[model samples]
Target: MCSTVVTPTDRVQPDVALPFGGWSAIVRDMSEEQSTSEPTRAFREARDFLLAHREDYETAYRDFDWPRFDRFNWACDWFDALAVEQPGVAALTIVEEDGEVNSLTYAEMAERSRQVAGWLTGAGLQPGDRVLIVLGNTIPLWEVMLACIRAGAVMIPATTLLTDADLADRITRGGVRAVVTSSSEAPRYEGIADHCIRVGIGGPVDGWLDYEDSRGYDGPVPEVDTAAHDSLLLYFTSGTTSQPKLVEHTQVSYPVGHLSTMYWIGLQPGDVHLNVSSPGWAKHSWSNVFAPWNAGATVFLCNYTRFDAEKMLQVLATYGVTTFCAPPTVWRMLIQADLSAVEIQIRECISAGEPLNPEVIEQVRNAWDVTIRDGYGQTETTAQIGNPPGQPVKLGSMGRPLPGYSIALVDPTTDEVGDDGEICIELAPPPVPLMRGYRDAKELTEESMRGGFYHTGDVASRDEEGYITYVGRSDDVFKASDYRISPFELESVLIEHPAVAEAAVVPSPDPVRLAVPKAYVVLAAGREPSRELAGEILQFCRDHLAPYKRIRRIEFAELPKTISGKIRRVELRADEAAKVDGGERTEHSYDEADFKQA
Candidate 1:
């Protein structure tokens, strides 16, 4: 086992963790020195096993064990340990719009983080204090995250895109004691609670302290000890249907738990990884922070105010990004560009945030000769299922369960395990990556963690080979003509049409069939919303989908989405329900019957 296992960046131990106080006291008594901690050796052994068998999924799955340790800190343990051995290695790199590139070596990052941790300690931040970090993909972001982890403080990562209202909600619910954001965003924090400490990046502010000052703090700070189960981060989920849930993760849960995510992305030591996600969300941490770092890979970021696929490709080519992860929305836009015009250095490409549409995957393979593997995870857990490297990717399948995850499909009606049903995880051996629970919502958390399983609230179908196909969200799946319907199945087929840019399928009410598939589509830039175009799209779906799955109603309008860029099918479902007289044609809507009569 390597020295990165149980080591932390800090050299001193605190009396207790913030808010929750001292779970660390016991951990402290058990082991004062982590260099020889038994649990740390176990964790290193587990991590090395996955990396050793990155492509051999069957052997890795059969052997991987979730490392259990009472005292663990990723910053000092894994990252700084690597710095000691490979100090000059690149840890993080960012490319600006005007071609200004900034990078930090592993040693530089570790020491800089220690400086920030020392500064934060001077600011009276103690263990367990919730620090809400709101910054762009700046170097300070990484510094602050490591500082918080080293201090045994709970870090709440927020995107700069979050509104002032979102910050208020998080502060109230998350009990934030400190906030770090840019000076331009400082005005948003006006009249916030006086208890919250504000640290501004870039320039300075009247009442805010400049983040640049952290570099001046050359003082030493002791390593803060936190238990494996102590709260480390509180993530506010991007709500697609209901209000956002405050998902909590302990120290090991995310830092150590992302071993699966590391395996899923097929990250290797010294690989340059570029993950397309803004700060604040779970996926950003998944690929950008934990997964890549777990494998000793360098994280690359291309900062852009506005997305340009061609420009991004140029950056990817320049940076020699070995591994890449992007959301399906970004993938769809990339397919729109002339992929052949640009060169890409990315060897492994993965898609998440939403299921990968097969058409998008195929187009990229045709253009780049690399398959875009799909992965499935959420704010609640690390990468649980993914099409890992070297595996034959079955189109539309999100691969088999990654090591450390025990997946089961349970029929909601029967509550019995089967080939298809609600996707759940076995709790007998609860996966290490799974979140503790939704903060302050015991009822909701219990409901989600019932039956000795963690219910994912999504549905999927499993094959004999253990490959699972995402059906749809549990609520989004409906019955049409006495047959079960998966919106994803219909939507995937609909996007294959050349005229469709993006598509969302919902159950449209019908008198005869009780309900029928209706597609709410956004047309490609050059296409018109005429009945003629609608006929071609419906015909395309009819030829590919089952008879019952055929889209009977078409609405060529902009699809509604949440702030986080998820297609809000619930809103579309409600709009269809609002229609009177059973069903009637609306603006830009074309029924299949009208097109057939043509």
Candidate 2:
């Protein structure tokens, strides 16, 4: 299922990865503007190094350095540079469900964003103002992003799916000063941020300025002279807890940090890159906005209210998509459809949001002749580990530490380095990609970056050859019958069953054994829930899994997920805990002992 995307014959040996700084460097004795360009140079040098070594991981990882910047504005320096270099090249293209297409070339995008910046500035937007954006993959979203950067305003990306209450919390937490949304979504902001300036797209609304007005503002908006440490975006992480955490990204952090993301994705200039991600989440910025564009590739989008794998494949082929990124959920849905039916010219495929099942990767490689590489990242930083292009990828491993990242697996009990432990990023010099910290939560921030490392709070196992296979979340990994269990491992096996489409494994309380593994499964299309089906699955699990690891209980239900589509195992585990304490029988649950072993 795994194969190298490039050969040694493709490029010569000058391919070194981004190794700009292990010690943070700030250019001295230079003008403020000149100093800004110095880090930009350092950033570009590092970027070009990764591009040169896109297929040569061994040399890249060993030699890569982190670029340091004191002042960096990506929208002005980097994006505008690309626009000037490749004016007529496609930068953004979106296909609507009705077959209508909208596009902007690099030059056109730059011009439009400049116009938007001018309009927003004229309408009372000031430097450091937080603008909450709630929109789909439309033209204005891109325009506002660049516009915010030009004005030195911090952008807070919110999904169209947010309710009025969600908007209130974000406005209060993020300190809203303005709001940009579609005419349809403008109503959601009423009384949320009442004094906040409202710019609505599509059509005019009462007490709201139309985005169409920006078309008339013809003058260019000058760039804001911003420091690298200035906050550019505030992301509210999708959390399983009651309230989400606000993650702050600096002007350089995402814009410059995504050089690592660009390297991991193996993006090349002029390639049409499509990443399936919601706008509000960090992954959207990781792949959709920053990564592909960081590589000077086209950011492609297909707007849809519902997912249709066949229709999506059609769009992919029609647009000649060269690079594709989708979540594990989308990949699972694609495998259910007839993938061979659609002929795509996709050269690179990546899965994020969760670890992709090996079975899903095998299915895709069989049909497309290209492997679906998996990557590991978090909202706190850019891509840390990934199977880069042309590298020999291990089936379950998410490759090694990216060019700028220094990964360590530290044992929880002893705080010693080990092969299997919590994934932590070396922070002695601090990677540029790391977030400034948790916004307004200094205690939590210090706690996370404590002990000379930025703890990822995720666990994994590193093999002898340097491949890291994902275990489960630190919280989700539990002990069953005194043996540690990884939910990801069990869920990976469950999905291999013919009847199962998606699965989440959690520790179920058991009086005799202390705890046992239980699975909550969603059946494949045309498969109905019944004791017959559950028994069949139990038998399958019993046959394939170890005795202690076998599924002791099964429940047929839709998995609980965050709005960003990540399955929430903590919720399921909580349910199991309540059942054990209350002595309540779980509804629609089937016990493996009901169908005794042969």
Model 1 TM-score, 2 decimals: 0.92
| TM-score for all models, in order of appearance | 0.92, 0.92
Off by over 4 Å in 1: 1-40, 579-586
Clashes of each: 12, 7
Q: lDDT per residue, candidate 1, 199-221, as tens digits?
A: 98879898877888886775666
- Residue 592, model 1, lDDT: 87
Cα lDDT of model 2 by residue, 94-152, tens digit: 88999877777766777677778889999999989999999888978988998899889
RMSD in order of candidates? 6.2, 7.4
Off by over 4 Å in 2: 1-40, 580-587
Worst 10 residues of 1 by lDDT: 11-20
